[model samples]
Target: MTAPIALHGSNISYFTGKLENYFRVKGLDYTLHAMKFPGDGKRIERELGVYQMPVLQLADGRWMTDSTKIIQWFETEQPTPALIPANPAVAFICYLLEDYADEWLWRPAMHYRWYYDEGAHFAGRHLADEHLGSLPVPGALKRAFMRHRQRSGYTRGDGITADAVAGVEAIFLRLLEQLETIFRSRPFLLGERPTLADIGFSGPFFRHFALDPVPLEVIRQRAPAVLEWVARLWNTRASDCTGSEPDSVPTDLGPLLEAIGNEYLPYLNANVAAVAAGKKRFDADIGGVGYRGARYSRYRVWCLAELRRQFEVLPEAARADVQALLQQHGCWEPLWQEKLLPLLPGQDEGLPFRASTKMVGANETV
Candidate 1:
């Protein structure tokens, strides 16, 4: 037996909830500790080289950051009850879904949490109590600061303008309808047991979509099955699941893949262009929404590069199958749109221990 790892982050944080779900499913022992500001900010930055939530302090005194990398590291260390499916093509599909869920769904998730008055008030109050209690500021003042910082960094400051708000929200609605169909037919995204795909999605659903007031109401009304899935995943343990690996991907997942192809990949391509051109902010028309001066992410540029790297390492047969699936869903062309990605030297090389950048670099203090 090992000592429980110290996980530090706000209880309501998006990435924190994601790491929690992954740890629960894997049956990994961990203790969740609040990331009190001022002190924790400096400590985490020193330990991990970036100020991000859900920093995992291992039993051996080593610290880890970034939920995706942490989960991958555990998957390597504890290979039984694999979170990634055994089928080669299915495994690649899991990576695709995870990436889509991580980077693309994040937009709508933040929009819902900060753009609406109900959601902002609810999350603001919770976060203020959870992380800002040590600031010695008035409770109301802390809540107001939380709201302003989030709205400035994530929603309005990131890209969701009045004209784009409706379109940005429609992304969530479409995802819910698609996921609602799949969850109604299966226990998890792939089959009877959870996979990386499900864990990836837990980033958004567990913290934002299922918990935020506005999106929670939307889920309760239209996608109750998805709501059930949220709780079901948290209660599930990977060691207890006896389901067989899927031989083929479900057809119902086509809608989600199509969305990744049509919307997310294109957005990545646009971000790539922006990074290559040395722009901090750029305008893009994605999913028919004109986003003016939206923040450009160097981290997201690495995400695109990482996805292609994942594809390149696939077995020959698996690569062929993945190519066909991605092509079928209109993902292939845009995925490889940039023949040469403009990446900095050794970007994100020291992941899980040290980070070169945050998801959104503009607002680090928040």
Candidate 2:
């Protein structure tokens, strides 16, 4: 038989852990290859056009980057033990929550990995040793540089300032509490089986928050059940249980959704504005702390666009229910209000987009 598909990423990566654990849960046969970073031809920038980890190379040699997209690819191939729900409302909620976990949770994950002296040192050592091992650079030099680079990047990237510590900490603690509450009853975020929602949350929880030495201790102390779920995601198989039910989003998931709306939406709004304004970065206040994001992100904009598109196609009753739930959790306005507009005509508009009005315009296209 052909070898299982290859996941080119390191264990220390957030999305890597997300997809790695997901493949196991889905019962897909896959092999893990440590991704080489910086000047390595094995997974170079020209191939991916970006420096990112956790790309899945398919059997025919096509590379699939972006964690959410990869999960969708699996959905098409498997379809049983489905990662997304059948109910339009629940499925759409999974899309938004998955987007939340994929994009927004990166802040806390990065903060934990790089903000502290111990965590930074620990992560830097692992990153350099793993990804930079075969490079011409000296081990000590690369390790120190990696340490400084990641910490500085995270600090500036996520607005991890001294004053921002409390807010970030609050998010981490609340997430742990909510996961514990939900997992105490159900096996996964959505219901009886693992879904996109579980994989989404597992991204940060498995690698950074739960696995990192510093945050792992915090998790163990405050919410050990969260850790158990992470382990379960890594160890369980699709056949282990049936899956999430149709037409339902668990009541316990409300806190998780509320946190997503409370925290992630604001940052997403700023990024959307930045994409529209043709600026590389935008300012926003998250957790009451001011931050200037490093740059605009097209993928995240696409995530919002995809959610809106999915919501638009749902049946009327389902749409209304989903919108109401979003409103209750504080997620409706931004997504519903500012739609992703068309690409700039005759060019790859390097910029992201938001519709000028409610309707898709003559210039509009996904």
Q: Which of the numbered candidates is closest to the native, going by highest lDDT? A: 1
The top-ranked prediction according to TM-score is: 1
Residue pairs with backbone overlap in model 1: none
In model 1, where do residues sit more than 4 Å from their true spots?
Answer: 358-366
What CA RMSD would you report for each candidate? 1.4, 5.6
- Residue 336 of model 2: what lDDT? 58
Q: Where does candidate 2 have its weakest 10-residue lDDT segment?
A: 357-366
TM-score of each: 0.97, 0.88
Worst 10 residues of 1 by lDDT: 357-366
Clashing pairs in 2: 342-365
Clashes of 1: 0
> Residue-wise lDDT of candidate 1 within 71-98, one digit each (tens)?
8888898887799888878988898899
